[model samples]
Target: MVPERRRLLSRRWFYLLLLLPGLLFALPLAEEDLNAIRSVTDFYGQRAGKRMQAWRELIQRGKQQQWDEKRALTEVNRFFNQMKFLSDVVLWGKNDYWASPMEFIGAGGGDCEDYSIAKYFSLLELGLNDEKLRMVYVKSLTYQQFHMVVAYYPTPAAIPLILDNIDVAIKPATQRKDLVPVFSFNGSHLWLMKERGQGQLAGSSSRLTLWNDLRSRFSSEKLKRPKLNLDD
Candidate 1:
């Protein structure tokens, strides 16, 4: 009887050992997933500071230039254009490429995507409706790897005007098929792969599950990191 009891105990221990391997494998994957989400959150949170500054600048620029919709877009274009192409190149290569507008303004520099994001939020502050704007990720005809730009859609199904670092002219989206749209997102929603979808289908996904985490990081506390002279 004692030997049978001992055999049963041994089998219990073997089963427990089998469970350990699965737990070990799952632990790292869980951490990696969490880290990826955290990275996105960190990116947006850092930009919050720059976003605020950009908005303030926009307000001043509007007052100075008698801001209207067309002028606002032009002024935004001009502001980004002044940075030239080099900034965009550097920003793209850096693993820490772009920050939120708040972080970007505080840092004083960012890649093309950063400029686009800044302008998007600035337009929002200026009372541009969310439906009219999208931050689009695209493939550049000339450059390798993914690139980002803003597409302003004045109405649903209307062609969008592309704001690009490579060119100053704001052209229609259809004019450039070189830019195969990977995804389009606005301030409130991230559209997977395309812009059109039902409202009920908009928010359900593990992909966008990181948004709340990203949003929380945008609080003022995160923006208080000691400012660096990003111009350098």
Candidate 2:
């Protein structure tokens, strides 16, 4: 009986030893994964903070400039002309979904969507009416993939003026049917352009949810880093 009891205790000790090495290895890997997640979160948070700061500054400057609609539109066009359109590097780079405008402004890089998004927010800050502006997502004719642009519609029935990085000139939306519209969103709303159709209001609940999400997620701080000649 004594011999049997001693053997059982010895077996339990052996099992404990076997488990120790595996746990030791797993701990480091777990720590590394946690650290990676933290790093990504921090990066996005910092970028968002920067974007918010930029928006504030831009708004203040716009107020000081006292630009009327015509002058503001001209300035916007000039600015678009100077900016290098979104590069493939910026398009493919993995980053946060809601990239603060500040990140784009800071890095001097962005994709088509980034340019449209930034411009849309900037125009809004400069006093462009929310109802008149939208960020349109579409399938590009040349690239055969998703792309985006800001469209300005003066009236409900009027064709929108396209603000695109692919072309320097602002053209009528009707002329660009090659761009199949997927959806359109703005600072305050989202539209199911292809299905619900353009000019019709989206569901209030959906619009409110979208508006809140965008408001909370997007930041204009990157613009504050330093003014780059954003003129196209």
Q: TM-score for every candidate vs. truth?
A: 0.60, 0.59
Output candidate 1 Cα RMSD.
21.6
Q: Per-residue alpha-carbon lDDT of model 2 for 1-232, expressed as tens digits?
A: 6997896675455434433433443322234334433443344443332333333443444556678755655555545333345554444344423334544543445667667767777787688898888888788887898888888888876788888888757878877766878778775566767532374557542454434544565432222222232211
Write down the worst ten-residue block by lDDT for model 1.
196-205
So what's the TM-score on candidate 2?
Answer: 0.59
Return the top candidate by TM-score. 1
Candidate lDDT (C-alpha), each:
0.57, 0.57
